[model samples]
Target: MTILLWILIAVCFIASFVGLVYPIIPSAPLLIVGFLIYGFGFGFTELTISFWVIQSVFIILLFTLDYLVSSYTVDRRGGSRAAKIATTVGLIAGPFIIPGVGLLIFPFVFAILTEKIISKKTWNESMSIGIGTVLGILSSALLKGIAMLLMIVVFILYIV
Candidate 1:
């Protein structure tokens, strides 16, 4: 029983990391679920109030990063609302289409097309916005990944 619980917890953590690349997955919730499993399995005596407070902060950060990072970068690059929407569509559809590289390529292509066609931007400007979209995605992923790692570490510290 103990081993099974450990495996379940590990799966949740692994799935949360996978969510970094596949934005469709709810990364923060999965981590929280993992912690809950630990609590339910072994009791929450070890998970103190400080642990919950810290985890809550990280959860908020994760949600903020998910909402703001990509759009913020696109907006900073002068991408229009259409471009931002297109970029989001590309990010969600990319992995399903190209398997691995689609995530980057689709967003770049979508943003550029939206800027050049819908926004009436010049070629160079469109490309710049495209680049910004990709950068934003990367930035969001990196920050979220770090935050999730910290969450896991905190969980371990509390439990161990």
Candidate 2:
């Protein structure tokens, strides 16, 4: 049972990272679930109050990063709400459709097309938005990846 719980917790942590690419997965919640499993299955004895507080802050940061980074990037490039929406859709669909590169390509293409067709932006502006979307995706992933690493570190420090 102990090993099984640990495996489940590890899966949650991994899935949380995977969620960075596939926005449909609830990344923060998965992390919380992993912690909860530790608390319940093994014991919460080592998980001090500070641990929870720090994790809570990281959770908030994760959520904020997810929303602010991508939106800000697109908006800075004069992208419309439609472009933002399409970028999200592309993020979710990209990996499955075209594998690794699709992650970047789909969002870029989607953002540009949405700007051109739905927002009636010029080709130049549309291209700018596409570039912004890709940049946003890359930066957001970098930040979130760091945060996730710190989160896991905190968990490890608390337990061992």
User: What stretches of model 1 exceed 4 Å from their correct place?
Assistant: none
Best-fitting candidate, scored by lDDT? 1
Cα lDDT tens digits for candidate 1, 36-120:
9999999999999999999999999998987799878998999999998898899899988987688899999999999999889
lDDT (tens digit, per residue) of candidate 2 on 1-160 = 9999999999999999988777778888999899999999989999889999999999999889978999999989898988998998899899889877888999999999999998888999999999999999999998998999899999999999
**TM-score of model 2 vs. true structure:** 0.93
Residue pairs in clash, model 2: none
Pull out the clashing pairs in model 1.
none
TM-score for each candidate, following the candidate numbering: 0.96, 0.93
Provide the global lDDT of candidate 1 against the true structure.
0.93
